[model samples]
Target: MRLLDNIYAGERVSAADAVRLFELNLTELGAVADFRRRQAVPDERVGYIVDRIVNYSNRCVACCEFCAFHADAGMIAPYDLSFEEIIEKIGELVVGGGTQVMLQGGLHPDHPLDWYLDLLRCVKTSFPHIWLHSFSPAEIVHIAILEGMSHGEVIGRMKTAGLDSVPGASDLLVDSVRRRVSPRKCTRGQWREVMLALRDADMVSSATMTYGLDETLEERVEHLCFVRTVQDETGILQAFIPWSFSPANTRMCEVAPAGGVDYLKTVAVARIVLDNVDHIQAGWLTEGPELAQLALCMGANDMGGVLTEELVVQAAGIHTRLTAADMEDLIQNAGKIPMRRDSRYQELGHEG
Candidate 1:
């Protein structure tokens, strides 16, 4: 109760307090988290975005143990979307009234930094109105390492080329978990450095966490603290998104996946812990719409995006899709106003 009292008194919860909050029953945790959510949001409105995630290439050298989306060179024939193909995808998004495009891809071994810059320029030239919220810190780090450039230089160039914002795809922010799951990908320190670079460039981005990868709850709390610390320093993180890891069809297929209760608890705890971040996103792509709908009451204020197409989680054998209309209806049915938002959490319109 004291923890809840402190949280309600506008005091920042410590890491130990976050871990203890996870020990509370679901109802108690959700109630406190919902209280924090109302204090932060102060509105009965839930926001969703009409966006698309374009995986330009599946070929990845990271070989993360939890990933089912990446293809090794010889395991499967890799394909990179031709510039024309990517344009076609964005065109389809535009036709669906999409305002944002997230160009996510694996760490391809051969692509040069110029290749990404050119793609960003090409997308901007083709659809200047579409918000290009693309790429993760891992991809930026890969580019920087490939080109012998600093992370700041890579982000600066991408910003100039019309990259509106970056996604916080630094899957698990704990170094221990990163070593166990994604050894070849950027380390926790590198991820922080790239985020600092984004802040330096005055570019806003989101923070994400993928739990249930055999990580301890304390490690999960550590991840939240890391995000909060970065937000305290940079103030560039606009949202915090926490999703359960899907292990099917991947190397870690033997691992039992997290269930809906864990997912909801994570969402509620994230909302309570990430007090500095403005928005907390509910991930329907992995958890399905029903649980995501329940997440609205458990502290999440954003339903993420109506992903026109999502392959990463689908590759793990979880296929959940929603259209803009479905999003509006879902939010309204949840007893909240359905507001459409862009990449920066700016309300575009609403359907009450």
Candidate 2:
């Protein structure tokens, strides 16, 4: 009750106290988080996006142990999608009534900066109205590595080339946990730097947590605190998405995956802790729509995108294909009005 009272009174909980939240009942956590969600976002409408995730290349240089999506360099048939091929994907998205496309890919070590810029140009040139919510902080850093430029410089150039926003991918934020899982990916400093740069460029992005990768409970709370700090400073993060780690077919496949209880607890804690971040999205792709529906009352305000198509998580053995209608039904079933939104969190329309 004190936790709920404190949260409702708008006080920040310490990291140690946050870790103790795990000891409480799952439904209690969800109830407090739902209370906070109502306090911040009183709307009974939950937002969903009609978007597709496009993987431009499976080629990767980062030796992330958790990823089964990447094709290691010089091993097997790793290839980048030709610009024309990418355009075709965009065409499908346009035809499918998709308002956004998440252009995700491995850190293609061979591609130059111009190659990415050209792709952005091509997308904007071909589809002017589609929100180009592409690339992760990791990808930006990779481009910087290839181009011998700063992360800020790469982000600025991408913005110039019509990149509307960035995704908070590869963000297991705690450096110790990150070193264990993705030592070759961007560091916490680099991730924070890129996010701040996006804020400076007026490009809002999401904050994410990919937990269950052998991280401590305190570390999880640390991640929430870190994102909240950034939000307090910039107030530009549009949402926070917490997803459980899927170990299927990965190098770390021997480990057991995070369960539904952990997923709900993380989502609820995120909603309660990330007081400055307006939105919290549950990953239906990884957690399934059933639990994702339960996550609505557990302090999630967004159902995320329908994801007409996806690949990375699919490679990790997660493939939940939900259309716009499926997403609307799921949200409605959760007792929330289903509202469609763009990548920028702009309300497009209501389903009912």
Candidate 3:
């Protein structure tokens, strides 16, 4: 097949066409994938940072069947981190050398929009340097619906209140699929609308995909195409991250996680498909460091972050934790430069 020729020449292919490219053996695939990576990001290398995911609240209204972190409606111990408590967590993260704080949480039923705005302001006020790269479009949509406000208004208010950027958790961009898993959540159109508003306001963010559930390969490609379209339209995507769905504590535990081969294949296809995006982030949290390192050869330019703390995945079942030094070692062992990056893809530091 002329797959490598088209990919190297920067031609988009359909998902059906892309699947044929994955049929090649590991050695051949690795060579082509590595060549593509070199072509895309030559002098630059994949980077990651030691950061923490301090989920402020687990009480959720949009209970996704695939999510294991959402607490039940009457579930007690669904603690909301007070301003003092969150500040302490940020202090610890900063002292531990974490430059970013992934402040994610569920859609707390009663918390006003000011609750989140106040949280963002408090985080920025307490630690002026810590990047509060928090919240997903889904969460924003949920809040807007509850507050009886438009998506644009909620996102504008949050951006003014000091949200750094959106997290890549829009999941499937198709509503039929999302309804199967998360009926109560925002529609796909709503999610995209929220992201569009954020982009229009000049806040760039990352996009993500969670595969290996009920979605087909064609659907996955559709998701990628949607991302590419949005990136082209908005010009605000910093990276693309594709992760496997972990069915641990979720209602969909019967569905198996995506295998390493499938994960690498998707990453390779993503590189070929999303030609406009600058970076492709491989999920070490879901695929482990070894497979994540292998993804570097399979066209991924970012090794994601060394999460000092995580909940969504932990709630799912996988536990692959690493330090900044460990991430450096992984990248070095994989024969790629280990550069540290801030929330944006700007190189913050480098290590051997």
- How high is the CA lDDT of each candidate model? 0.89, 0.86, 0.82
How many clashes in each structure?
A: 0, 0, 0
Candidate 1 local Cα displacement, residue 351, angstroms = 4.5
On TM-score, the leading prediction is 1
RMSD of 1: 1.4
Spell out the clash pairs found in candidate 3. Answer: none
lDDT of residue 232 for candidate 3: 80
Worst 10 residues of 3 by lDDT: 70-79
Rank by lDDT, highest first: 1, 2, 3
- In model 1, the worst 10-residue window by lDDT is 70-79
Ranking by TM-score: 1, 2, 3
Please write out the lDDT profile of model 1 over residues 1-352, one tens digit for every residue.
7888898787888899898987888999898899999998999989898899998889899989998888852333577889999999999999878999999999988999999999999999999999999999999999999999999999999999999899988688898888899999999888889889998999988899999999999999999999999999889998988998887777887889898988999999999889898799888788888888899999999998887778888788777778888899988888889989988788999754
Query: Candidate 2 lDDT, tens digit per residue, 1-102?
Result: 787678778788888878988888987888889988998889988999888888888888886888888885222257688889888988998998888888
lDDT of 1 at 170: 64
TM-score of 1: 0.97
- Winner of 1 and 2 under lDDT: 1
